[model samples]
Target: MNREERIRSLLDRIRSASLDAHGFVTELELQDFRKNLLVQRGVGMSLLMASECVVQLEAFSPDFVAEHPEIPWAMIRGMRNRMAHGYFDIDLNYVFQTAKHEVPDLVRIVETLLHIHPQGE
Candidate 1:
């Protein structure tokens, strides 16, 4: 696939993962998220997947990534790095907050990006 195609694929992956993460905690409380290992893992893995896609998206072209200043690319990359390097050390609070709030916003941003930047010019 070409660069644009790769970006489109990555955006789709990010959107899917974000949606899954958000859905996992649709009506969940922070205490419940902390208490349930399965839910915690599901959110963590979904965030990780989205972060990994962001990393790949950056790799495809930093310039292309730069064009989209709305996305928190650096923060996403940091999360990916943290998850990849020190999964056990991550704080559940941040994960819960991101899944509950940020992921939904991210899904909307990704959908806009997909619509604006189609597979081909």
Candidate 2:
């Protein structure tokens, strides 16, 4: 893909992943997220997927994110790297918190980007 195409493609992936994670986190409280292994795994995995998209998006062009400070680029990549490199050491609490808090803003910011930049911009 070309630069703009890559950006839009990456943004779409981020949107999909963010929506999934946000949906997963939205339904449960921290108490339930922490107590249930199924919930923990679901939330954690969703976050990991979202974070991976963030990283991949950055790899295409960090400038795409640098221009949009509203998106937590560093935090997103950091979460992905940490989870991918240190799977066992990851804190489920952190994943749940990110899904609950960060993913909403991410979904909004990315959707805005899609409109502001559009395809092939």
Candidate 3:
């Protein structure tokens, strides 16, 4: 697969993971998540998936931010960094809120990107 194709795949994976997490939240499958952490395991995994998607996008298209100046590259990268390096100190509430709110926006953005840049073999 080409770079854009790879990026699209990563975005799809991120979205799928987010949906799974949302399902878990909807199904109340996060007793451990709520008791052990402020958030649930599914939400944490969603954040990680989202972070990985952003990282893959950055890797595939370093100039993506320049191309789409509306996208917040710095903030996304910072979030990815925090998720990667500050694992132990992660705020579960923040993760839960982000998954509930920010992830849909990210999905929209990724979908737009995919539409604008069709993945070719």
Candidate 4:
């Protein structure tokens, strides 16, 4: 897909992942995510998917990220890179924090960007 279409698709995926994360509470999610092997894998994968979408958003150009100073673009991409490369040493706490908080904020920020710049300007 073209850049605009690609961005839109990434945004949708980000939104989906963020919504799925709502089922987990911070403390409870963190506990379950750490103790349960299946939960850990599932939650880790979702976090990875969401983080990947954030990284994909950066593909639009540094200008796109620059325009949205309110969003944590670098941190988002950093999280993805860290998780992608350090899969074995992944931090469960970070994953739960991301799912419980960051994903929703990231989705809202991207949705606002999409609304204000429908064609990605």
Candidate 5:
């Protein structure tokens, strides 16, 4: 895959991960996420997947990343670093909030970008 193909692929992966994260929280509350280890792991992994996609996307030129300001590119990459490195200090509250709220918005933003840009644009 070339640059555009790679970017599109990353965007698709991000969208999928974001949706997965959102789905993990669909019928639950913060307390539920906190108590359920499996749900927490599911959400965390979804977030990790999304963030990892952003990490790869960010590896491309800054200008390409800058073109899409709607997405929280820096935050996504930062979350990846934190989740990957901060093994003991991971904040479940923040993770829960992000998955419950931000992931859906991220999905919408990514979908919009995909629609606006189109393939190989």
Candidate 6:
């Protein structure tokens, strides 16, 4: 796929991963997620997936921030770096907060950019 398509795919993955993580706040959902290591792994994997998406976008899109200066590319890249190199030091609380607070905003920004970009197809 082309760059814009790749970016859209990444955003879609992020959205899907965020949906997968929706249960962490609910006691019933948390219980279900906690019961199986696979479930927890899935949640963690989603974060990694989102992180990878951001990194790939940064690498391929030269004008990422130039095109959408409102989006925090540096912060996103920093988080991706942390996720990649500091995986052992990752804090669950931070990840939880990011998933809850940041992912939605990122998804929105990405969708908006895709809408504006002529090459989004």
Tens digits of per-residue lDDT for model 1, 1-121: 8777888889999999999999999999999999999999999999999999899889878998999899999999999899788978989999999999888888999999899956667
Among these predictions, the greatest TM-score belongs to 1
For model 1, what is the alpha-carbon lDDT of residue 42? 90
Model 3 misplaced stretches (Cα beyond 4 Å): 26-33, 36-39, 117-121
- Considering lDDT, which of the candidate structures 2 and 5 is the better prediction for this target? 5
lDDT of each: 0.91, 0.79, 0.67, 0.73, 0.88, 0.63
Going through the candidates in order, what is the number of backbone clashes in each? 0, 0, 1, 0, 0, 0
* TM-score versus the correct structure, for each prediction: 0.94, 0.85, 0.72, 0.77, 0.93, 0.67
User: lDDT by residue for model 5 over 1-121, one digit each (tens)?
Assistant: 7877778888899999889999999899999889999998899999999899888888875677898888888888989999999877899999999998888888988898788778856
Q: Put the candidates in TM-score order, highest first.
A: 1, 5, 2, 4, 3, 6
Which residue pairs in model 6 clash with each other?
none
Candidate 3 lDDT over 60-103, as tens digits, reads 77775467766666676777688788878877666666666676
Worst 10 residues of 2 by lDDT: 38-47
- The lDDT, on a scale of 0 to 1, for candidate 1 is 0.91
- TM-score preference between candidates 2 and 3, better one: 2
Residue-wise C-alpha lDDT for candidate 2, range 17-68, written one tens digit per residue: 7778778778788888778887666667777777787777777787777788
Q: After superposition, how far is residue 104 of candidate 3 from its true place, in Å?
A: 1.3
The model with the greater lDDT, 5 or 6, is 5
What are the RMSD figures for all models against the true structure?
Answer: 1.3, 1.9, 3.4, 2.9, 1.4, 3.7
Superposed on all Cα atoms, model 4 deviates from the true structure by an RMSD in Å of 2.9
Worst 10 residues of 4 by lDDT: 21-30
User: Which candidate's lDDT is highest?
Assistant: 1
1 or 5: which has the higher TM-score? 1
